[model samples]
Target: MNGRWAVGLVAGSGTPSERIAAELRRRIVAGELALGARVPSTRRITREWGVAMATATKVLNRLRDEGLVRAVPGVGTVVAGKPAPAAGRSREPQRVSPRASQRMAERMPEQAPEPASRREARPEAESTGARRVRAGGERDLTRERIVATALRVADQEGLTALSMRRVATDLGVATMSLYRHVPGKDDLLRLMMDVAFGEQPLPEPPASDWREGLETVARVQWRIYRRHPWLASTMSFTRPVLAPDAALHTERSIAVLAGRGLSWEEMAQASVALAAFVCGLAVHFEREAQAEQDSGLSAEEWMDRVEGEDHERLTADPERFPMFDAMNRGPEIDLGLEALFEFGMARMLDGIGLLIEQRGGEGGGLARGSANK
Candidate 1:
């Protein structure tokens, strides 16, 4: 069907479904849609016009009410070969039962009651205060609202529990309505990731040195992962999610690595390596949080319960592993993730600095042998 006509009718509408039904009614009346022609199903209506399933169903029901269509056993709803009712005329009003009217009021609170004369004739159709309640329940539903709701769900429950339906429930809308805003769950996830990365932006005028720039990017990502524990698992090394905001972290890292007398390949590898390191460690953030919640014990407390026994068992055979015993002979070591991240980052940067020094040697990238092979 031509969708342009529906755009013009949007401002002249009763509801979204009514506008769509009017367009289809025009088609049936004008013979643009031939007799016995298949009418657009609810799925097609949603795909074509980007409306919720409830709205699409209403569209079909409106056409059926107008005697312009009928449902075939298996072929789907089709145009009924009936003469068109004259313009400005409609079928006689059907009396609605109180139970059905109540249900309608519950679902469609925006609908006003029938005229007082009609209600006097059929008191069952009267809906008490229906127009005053829930008139704008979904009026503020925007792409931003959907994305924000999904982000909160993922942050609190992890990616495994985050779904389009879950977000719609949180927003108190139909599940299919979310599809009108976001294409699907994958697209929603991409949006969520972009929002997460954009939350803490890289500083302006990039860090002074390459090391500082990388550290700044890494720490910023760490903080993001810490805030939204589920974000780390969404990151990938082989198949990177192409979120523009997330790429800014890499862009800043690579920019600082530029003009450092390093090869382009080396710069790329270093940038990815730094990001991968941060993400790799950050993966534990959600896992640890989940573990603590499930087991009702913090990391330190859990370790305290088993540390002595494990330590004694390992040291019991210290002679078989002298270096291990020698290292533990000193005061207890701090194995916190923060300390490990700091120490590992310093060591990794030290190694990268060594690579930079070696790159300045005889063979450029291959001071000892070919950097590639």
Candidate 2:
């Protein structure tokens, strides 16, 4: 309940739920939490320890299971060894079937096993290698591992398929256990984005001049989008996630324009402008791949398949759409993503280079217009 408990709850050794249960057990045993005193509820534990409700529930369940605490009708979860039961209540302990006992043995493996008993059905994931590893006392889990695993899942399958359960399955751990590392998918995505941007770190300056710096940054970002197609769509310039590597990328872009005679605001605009351009074009990277995969045909191939007699006749008429007919003729005229990206990258940098030469990168951001009457 105190800040001291957070030491082991957040990052110290042992699982978060185990650490909490042990702490509460120690408190109750030592009279720090006396009999009849209400222990922290699942909601309270979730808030105090910054763990998920599932983790907190597990802690309370463990405490109740150890007879260190018990639940009352009106009262909340209280310390164990309380006064005699009320008149209407029975003191007899609830029965646990042999199969249930065996299941309990399988679940709470940290405790001693109960007597041999029947085994009922188990969930497919329950008896999995993940459970086995957890049962065997493997305890080296970290936030880095969780983030890395989630990134790998996103890389293989697109970001849409990257749920916490899938990552937990890949890592051979319970879905809730991931909450102990990352709060949720948004936090995990932030970490993943940071890691992705960090993957191809820019040079100290990454460019010699303004033109070269802008080009280099855009090219590097384009390459990353190709590597992880979903990355382009995960990012947003308007509402950027607070990732260190993402910030670093922007910093380097702005830094390259230093001494180019641009104001700080102008430098920021230049950097954001280039990044936004790359992201806009890069957005189509995943969509095209997914489209081709789903339809089993390339864009050109699909067009050919869907082309009708009218389309042929329309294209054959040079007088009606002369420029269109001529431009659409060559089979080699494949305006692929890579080609477009290179072409656009060159043109954008050219425009930026022209701006730098003309304005000397001076401030010209949105001249405040007079109010409309």
Whole-model lDDT values for every prediction:
0.69, 0.66
Candidate 1 ranges beyond 4 A from true positions: 1-135, 361-373
Candidate number achieving the greatest lDDT relative to the actual structure:
1
Clashes of each: 0, 0
Each candidate structure's TM-score, on Cα atoms with residue i matched to residue i, is 0.60, 0.58
Scored by TM-score, the top model is: 1
User: TM-score of the candidate numbered 2?
Assistant: 0.58
Q: Could you give candidate 1's per-residue lDDT for residues 1-373 as a string of tens digits? A: 3576545565574788878887787777677876556677666677667777767766865565444565442234666544435665434333334665466457543222344463333212113301121234367778989999888766754565567765764565667777888999888989999999998988999976777778888899989988888888888889988999999988898888777778889888988998899888999988886566445467888998998897787788888877767776987788788987887776666667678767662212222332322
Off by over 4 Å in 2: 1-138, 298-320, 361-373
Candidate 2 lDDT score relative to the true structure? 0.66
